[model samples]
Target: MSSLDAEPHAPGADAPRSPGPLLAIESSCDETAAAVIAADRSVLSSVVSSQAALHERFGGVVPEIASRAHVERILPVIREALAEANVTPTDLSAIAVVTHPGLVGSLLVGVTAAKTLAAVWDLPLIAVDHLRAHLYACRIAYGEEAFPACGLVVSGGHTNWYDCPDAVRATLIGSTIDDAAGEAFDKVARLLGLPYPGGPSVQQAAEHGDPTAVPLPRPMMNRPELAVSFSGLKTAVRYAALGNPNSPEVPAPPLGERRIADLAASFQAAAVDVLVGKCDLALKQTGRPTLLVGGGVAANRALRVGLTDLCERRGVRLCIAPMELCVDNAAMAGLAWESFERGEFAPLDCDVTPGLVRA
Candidate 1:
């Protein structure tokens, strides 16, 4: 589930469950997460250890720090997930981990652990694409109906939309030419002197301010295709909050609490507008009747509202990942079942392909 999407079942639901589950590890970024999901989609236990605190002082994720933390927490988090699920490694059908399109160091932590466990336990090893896993969160929420839909995967490292023909297939339609929306939020927040991990910070401040207070630009709006842009928008926020660096005539105003709020509201509104606007175009181009949105930024309240409104007006079906599944978590690794059944296993020597956004 995209924390940006909405789902209902609580994590680690306690009740008599399936015989075997796939143990999944997700250390693709700053979060060290593990989960046990049965073939029947029974999410026995999902655990995540975030290194947000460690990265907060740095303004963003530091690759080296994230990798080290993952090494420290992956095993413990996996142990906790198994304990909560009431299962052992031998009880799992396979070992799965997100192995691509993320920080190489962070991805390696999870991949190495999964491979070691798989080899030690004699279990099948499955590698999951980080982007596909985000899409699978929709399937975990909506079942088979989530397929043949338009998917928008928005996160810190990705802001690309796809035409998903099934759980295992996606075709890139359009994407950001520069910074992803989450990056824009972070940089804009810093411009406004807000806290790190800007999506939540900006969303919070935006609640009390007017969205129209500052006139922000929405780049690449009329480009017929689904191509999206946010770098220009972020620069616009910077100029609005701090006077143009090269200008000498006018001095930048102080960022009072209220002024910050207004700028936050305006920047968020512009970003959401472009994000939702692209979704509108994606649906038209793909001729798909459903829209599936996942990724960390999908959690933005304003973006969700905009997507809901877009689907409603277009008479399109909407399936979003639940709040718990929304952020990077193991429950979504339920997709591993598909690969396992299809006999698609990863070699122990496989390495992570970081920052590789499949075009």
Candidate 2:
């Protein structure tokens, strides 16, 4: 049977036209994810294959390793999603893929896979912006009421603010001038001898440490612009952890558990302070009554608490993507349905964009 005939209908009445299931693929970074989502925002199945272990020894994501991993996992992940959703390729109304602002090699794997599938299945192709997909996680979690708000996308590779008037349109309002929030966390975690994917590790350590135990600078706090900077804050953590680089001939003292916890707490607090401050400023400047925050960093307990408190005080509605959706995943890419509804399908010649700022 065709997908249109399978759509749900109101009781005792004819069913109105609605979008069919869409298959979305996301490989913008290290995660290879796929999902099948219906027009009513119901996610039938979502699958993600992570490469965290493969890059753990390197203390960060190695681009080559990540891309290779994606190439190996993308097909299986997509197949699993389709199987779990109980749908075949021909059942899908369109195929969506994130095509921008990520490791180029990684992006290419997903894009090429999606393009080949679209050609074979004769499906409409929709191109999604990786960062916008992060924000769309909020919309997925909260429904249509989440828009007309200020969006903050904080992740390992991106820290950007947007004025999101709707699901498909976002105006860039502010961004990081240096390292992203999650990137800084990873760097500091490495300095403290913590594991890869620093946000959770740092949060866990900070739970036992006093946030005020040590002082860390809040970069760009006084700047009039809404931009945030974490490079200086990251350096401060490095100095506190390792002392001066020039005078480090002597073996440095081992970081006690308490010292590590304290440093993590202090650094997390400073980063949260700057992020909250900038979010507050964005809301005021844009006059947006709602605030939507997503991306991997949105999973941080500290950031969640900070944003919740800020939104409460300012009377702004706050919608944070659930932890599962906050991290890179294709479920969020279900946002492609919005473009599909607007007839914004991409041509077969579309290419990947690797930079954050798009024209």
Candidate 3:
């Protein structure tokens, strides 16, 4: 019997039983996270152990390092989450884990842990898609009123659009053919000598500079399909900053604070334009009156402002997940509740799909 149907009380019992909390784990990337969420959509506790520092020197996440870190942190993170929520394994209604579209080793860390817990505790296991969880963050933030919208997951590992008819189903509509928006940010930041995890750094530097000062190409802005391409744009930034690498080294002038700021601002503006423009197309194609934006890049202030303006002009409802939920976190995996409600539990033998996505 499913956990949802495992209530012990007889039919028509005088006292109704409260739903047990669901334990969700997310180790899809560099962040190791766990959360306790009730069936009523209450997030009791959310804990994330980020490997930003470990990956900072490398400029991006290293799969082996990330997976090893997840192995070390997953148990502690899950323990803390349950403790914070005042719930134990016995108090859990089910165990949910992101099992797809991530570094294989990192995914195994979480999947193995979840399966172990599920087996030991005899709890139901629910598999969640990482990208869907990002989009589902909006639903978690806004409740049932947030769906029937266009969902975009723009982050370091993904840039994909979806037609979300409700909390449980998402139809993939468009995606990036090259670099993800957040990856572009990181590359640009590296070229400008900024810190790793470039989204925030670029946003900060752009504040003091003129966005129009630098002219960068906006790739795929006029493309026929709803797809986006950032590789060309990234190449454009490289040529602008370092000059033609194919040609002899002309003594290029140093990039001063002002110049770097302008480049950051300009690149940010161009990227935001592409994102907002694609969102416009998605909204039109799906006829979705609402637009839901999620993933790490959703935390960009400029992107938020641009999206807000676009939605206002188009008369579309916009819901951006809070900063906490914008990044990879298990709290967003509260999305598992949807599967739990439908009694869609995965067997212990279910394995991870490293690069899974809907067609």
TM-scores of the candidates are: 0.93, 0.93, 0.94
Q: Give the local distance difference test score of model 3.
A: 0.89
Alpha-carbon deviation at 182 in model 1, angstroms: 0.5
Model 3 misplaced regions, further than 4 Å: 1-16, 246-253
lDDT of each: 0.86, 0.89, 0.89
Determine the backbone clash count of candidate 1.
11
Candidate 2, residues 166-221, lDDT tens digits: the string is 88889998999889999999999999988988999999999999999878899998
> Which digits, one per residue and each the tens of the lDDT, describe model 1 over residues 20-76?
788899989999999999887778999989888898877889999999999999888
- Ten contiguous residues minimizing lDDT sum, candidate 2: 2-11
